[model samples]
Target: KTRPVLDLRPLPKVMADPEQFPKVVTNLLLNANEAIQKKGSLIRVSTSEEGGWAVLSVADDGCGISSAFLERDLFRPFRTTKKQGMGIGLFHSKKIVEAHRGRIEVESEEGKGTVFRVMLPVGDGVREDG
Candidate 1:
């Protein structure tokens, strides 16, 4: 229904839990898709390196989170805006990111869009070039 765009950038491999990383990305992507109610909207995913962190972000031009929810309810277990959402997706995502000593960031404007970023510390992984 909407355009999907990816602008992934190369980064030195960061050590992360094999299973949990995918789960986090999956949840983010799912949310991006679910946020859009318009047929011509967009969902974008990107990756990059910032300072000493590896960043992964999912953004969507769709109905965005309310400030009240963003400030108080997000990442809290069982507090959901969706009728079907269990609300654990974000809650567990936060836990997993923190377990890796990472943090999650949010940027949203109601009626405009939302961007969710997961920032993780650059792990000690051997460079392939070397």
Candidate 2:
């Protein structure tokens, strides 16, 4: 059995709530792990800069999500492919990202793989005015 491995890319410093960031990471990791049914699958985590945002991405070489689900079902509460899942993982992850004025996106092709991207603004604190 091969365990999932993470390949984390470098990232810049961004002002964010520390408490919520781990939740986002954990949710993505869980999703990646669930995609693979066998051992030796890989999960990659990377970060980079995109325009005014700090981009973080998690990729998995496992059973990928369907296009329909990627577009519609991923963020919905209580929607999961797994029989044992509560389905609140991605929902809560999305909420945490948005609360920090960020955006989360996913790319997946059935039988190929999946990639999840989270983008956050770079700043010292949340802007009160906006």
Candidate 3:
């Protein structure tokens, strides 16, 4: 088991539900953890601000998703390769992020790793005092 490295960069505030936003973070981290299949794997969580957006990225040096699966079934509910998975994590995550007017993206390569990025617009509900 490998501890995740966090690079929590300063980010502009976005309009997000305090209660629901943590679920997005938790689900992404949990999904990254479940992807690891061996010892010494690494998971990285990062935050940043880009072009008026607050970005949160979770990356894992674990089993990558197949290109076919990534295209067709990645966000479909109830479609999973894991024996214990119900395949709703990503599906639910997408709904939550989209509800916040944010977007989620992914990049993966077979035998390499995967990276998931969530970007939220940084304007509405943002405090200028900070």
Ranking by lDDT: 3, 1, 2
Error of 2 at 95 (Å): 0.6
Between candidates 1 and 3, which one is better according to lDDT? 3
Per-residue lDDT of candidate 2, residues 1-130 (tens digit): 4355555666667777888889999989888888866322878878787776789898888888888887778899999988798999999999998988888999887877789999888775354544
Collision pairs in model 3: none
Model 3 per-residue lDDT tens digits across residues 1-130: 6768999998876899999888989998887888886423899999999877899999998888899999999999999878898999899999999888888999998778899999888979443432
Quote the positional error of residue 106 for candidate 2 in Å: 0.5
- Pick by lDDT: 2 or 3, better one: 3
Query: What's the TM-score of every candidate structure?
Result: 0.91, 0.86, 0.91
* Evaluation by TM-score, superior candidate among 1 and 2: 1
Model 1 lDDT vs. the true structure? 0.86
- Say which candidate scores most in lDDT: 3
TM-score of model 2 (CA atoms): 0.86
lDDT of each: 0.86, 0.82, 0.87
Cα RMSD, model 1: 4.4
Q: Kindly report which residue stretches of model 1 are placed more than 4 angstroms away from their true locations once superposed.
A: 38-40, 125-130
lDDT for model 3, please. 0.87
